[model samples]
Target: MSSNNTSQIAAASALGRLSPVANAPSLESIVAAATQLVPLLREQGQQTEINRRLSEEMSRRFEEAGFYRLMQPARYGGYEYGFTAMMDLISEIGRGCASSAWAAALGVIHNWLLALFPEQAQDDVWGPTPNALMCGSYAPVTMAEPTEGGWLIQGKWKFASNVDNSQWAVLGVQFPPAEKGAPPGAGFVVVPRREWTIEDDWFVAGQAGTGSKTVVIGKPSFVPAHRRLLFPEAASGKAPGTAVNTNPVYTIPFLAAMPVCLASPLLGAAQGAIDVFVDMCGSRVTRGGAGGGGNRLSGFSHVQSRLAGAAAAVDAARLVLDRDTSEVEHTVSAGNAISVDKRIRNRRGHAYSAKLCHGAIQDLFTTVGASGLTLDQPIQRIWRDGNMIAQHITLNWDAVSTMAGQQMLGLEPKGAY
Candidate 1:
């Protein structure tokens, strides 16, 4: 067998030996190592803000650790590893630095998403460098027209995450018919950064370091037709990735996967809070005598109970997500339709995971005392970032619940995705 094939066999053998029901790495070890690296991230957090993006040093560390390659096809520079491990890894990063994790999460997942594009689009993005990073905004931010070989593209796509560093982007648009608004059909049009300029638009009260700017593409540029994609297929239960990837994990619904990827960073940020709170609570000596028994916060029955509940929520939410991914993977792998019931379950589970982590983080913030209120505090950043990101529709638990409930009751729910 070839050397590459040998490596795959060896890795698969090792994974088999582990016999993890999830078929992934030891989540704890990954979390521990990533947690240890958080302080280093925290030290450079201000620098990231000043640079208006993640520091090259931080990005290099992530790349060196093979973090960016998590979602890449193994034939390229990637592990093609378990989706669970990817979630564990991103959560750790989020705990330390939400924006870095958010940016990295977006950039990394884009690699996987590329596998869903047409081979020509894949060539346009990854043909250059397997490690080539791409970022994008999907909310139809411009006008695109049917033309020979490509679309005549114009307009600025906003919320383009990690744009300052990305080599390419997937700017989605709805191509209107020659007639005024004949049914709307969506397509993701690929554009190289060289053909577009990034506007400084990501300044905000939270996730400030994401550098989620806008891509301003005008008269000077357009993406070819081969680099574009149809939407109804993805919205229903299809994606081009199956033809190229042959990986069951990539077979999951396109819109479904977006929220799953996003909630991960938020969970990681909360876990980061938990890690710190545990440390801080362990070392404290309150007026009540080492908070009594020298166990610090652990000695306080109420604190212990809260921690227990929060930890339970975190674990519970993770289990739901794990179950959802597995089901999605299994069904799609077999060429089955992902039922509306399952999709609703997936959405509800995703929103709950985000909410669970949000509640846990909020509880920790309240319990961490005045130290967290300072601008220099790590918990403060985590608290702000988590709260802000949880507001995203993906984590809006009420909406997910409402939709799921309506669907179960044989009622139609409204929304594009």
Candidate 2:
């Protein structure tokens, strides 16, 4: 066996023989760590928004906690935990700062994708330098030309969250021109920082701190074939990395499981808005009316109704996310392929839940009166972030609903469903 193969075997064996460390971190402990960061993150939300990215200090804290390794392969010294653990952690962080949660989620989630590449590719990415942060944009707008040893790719990938903090990126690239009657080809190209440049263009109102700027592939960079992960293979829940990383968690359909990352943060943001609004309503006395100075806003019937509606919607969104994700987990554990219909349903389920979250935040924001309009208020930030998240193409309810409808009608769904 080659050195890399020997390393994989040794690492796997170590993981198998490993005993629980004293005070070893559990998912609950990780969630608590995230919760502990909330107050500090909330306090820094405005500053982070102005900076247009998460602080290096915050990123270091996350790395120190090993929070980003939740979905990484055990051979790479990762926890290889389930998606639900990650969801809970991200949601807890989102309750403090949506942008922080978003930046963190996008930055770390790519580790799971990286685990799908060939062993050599995985070694190239994480072997010598196992602690590198990764980010990606999966829009196949790049131009790829066939080359001797690899493909020469050139283009810009937009909305790459936390690109400023990453040392490597997974960029979407098209397969070389297909022959007549052949299906159009698409896949991911993993490239180190030396191959690409980060463009500063992430300025926006909502989730501004994500720093989801454009990634410019400076000149034509050559990515070897080993670094490529075809979308179809990933959709089928099989990939090169599966040969070494045998965990079922790593085999879940990429698209179906990824929506949780995009939607869960928004769910938590909406919940945060509700939390802030509820706390505000309790102490602030009503001004200018028969009930002025006598009635708290929480006492008003309309306020009560709006809070109830918002809370229920947020709860329902969380439930939908957990339910669908749990089902995907169970299916993977059973060694079964997730049906196309199920993937479509998962897509729509995420979009629907995000829509509900948007509406809940809207209701909550609308009921908060002028106080919510101020940029300083946490509710306003949550509202803005939730709105931005709802606008994500993955969470576009109308499009997802159409895809689901087409699948239901016995027609092929289109466009990354």
Candidate 3:
């Protein structure tokens, strides 16, 4: 049987509401589920790469464990746990396999974004299947024309991670042209899986299993107003569903808040690299036995220092994510909107954290020597994953640092920063 079919069967077999009633799974239970899945994810890491996406089994297991529902609304049977808990989950999963972690993180975060849409949109997705997965691309590429029902949308959205695993998609589009004085508007439109086609074009050297393919809308389709959420409304935390889904976690800004999910996995990947490197060090011996004796590679001060630095870098990355997420949470809990400065700081922190992850992977990879370059070596995969993550637009150091610098100078920060 095809992998997709097998995965569907697996997920269906394991399918049951994590929270059939109001009470959701305990944090400990949810975390344990993620922790336990690590070995399986690691075992499937190679297959995930070969398949160019996550396995059906892993996705189903995440559903059974309620990992995808961490930030979902309780009213819809989601756990609604805070972002910190989800980050912790993602980091733990990342240590096992970065690709799986990436797919899991993106697939889960899309649900949180859906929470910000109108109640009708939320119901349309979760009403039938609360366990239904959502995936998306933030780039506004669709063209919209004003129509009787709402707007007719057409175009393609790229880099939709884990698109195959999802039942719905939240796509970006430019609204129909506005009046002369009014600025052109951009927004997100909720479309069911049947409304769009997945372009199986996700080919990359790293994070290949994310299945971040292009989603195409061939003919125009009507999207009602209830399914549309403008960028401005989302960024200001004044979403349509705010009245119903009143959790403080939903109050976080969309642009500034979501990047944390992206960076979380990289930290885990770097840590995973460190773990494998340390293991390799313990067993690997240098040529000539390092002074004609049975000297372990780890016995060298050089290897020890590199390992120590990598660990410290990974630790620092975790701290940055924790601090930034906590501050955002505090702001929301205090009934205050996240300020522009604070949002800028989040961008800085996310980018810096990614930088630290990249450095950590590089530190360990460089010292591991030729064997580390082999395809079967786990650290090689980790190193590639880390490098690719650093390339993500949200985590690009130069661009984010520039934005932070602009904010510091009393000039308005540019772009998403």
Summarize candidate 2's per-residue lDDT along 1-417 as a digit string, tens digits: 899976754443233122123334677778888989988988899889999998899999888877787777767768776766677888889999999999888865788889888889999989988888888989899668888888899989999898888999889888865687776589998999988888898879899999899889868888898999988877778988899888887788898778888987898798888889988899877776555766778889999999999899989988787777777776776788888888888998899999999999999889878767777788888888999999999999988899999998999888575
Ranking by TM-score: 3, 2, 1
- The global Cα lDDT (0 to 1) of model 1 is 0.73
Q: Report the C-alpha lDDT of model 1 over 33-92, residue by residue, as the tens digit.
A: 667778888776666765668766777777766678777766565555445556777777
Model-by-model lDDT, in order? 0.73, 0.84, 0.84
Model 1 scores worst on lDDT over the 10 consecutive residues at 12-21
Clashing pairs in 2: none
The residue-by-residue lDDT of candidate 3 on 1-417, one tens digit each, is: 999976754443221212223567776777787778777776777778889988788898888888898888888877776677777888888988999899899877888889999999999999999888988987788668888878998888999999989888888888865687776689898899989999999999999989999998899888887899998878878788788998777778886668878998998888888878978998987776334556788888888999999899989989887777776775676788888888999999999999999999999999988888877788888888889999999899999999999999998778694
If both were scored by TM-score, which would come out higher, candidate 1 or candidate 3?
Answer: 3
Residue 348 accuracy (lDDT) in model 1: 85
Residue 75 alpha-carbon offset, candidate 2, angstroms: 1.4
- Residue 389 lDDT in candidate 3: 91
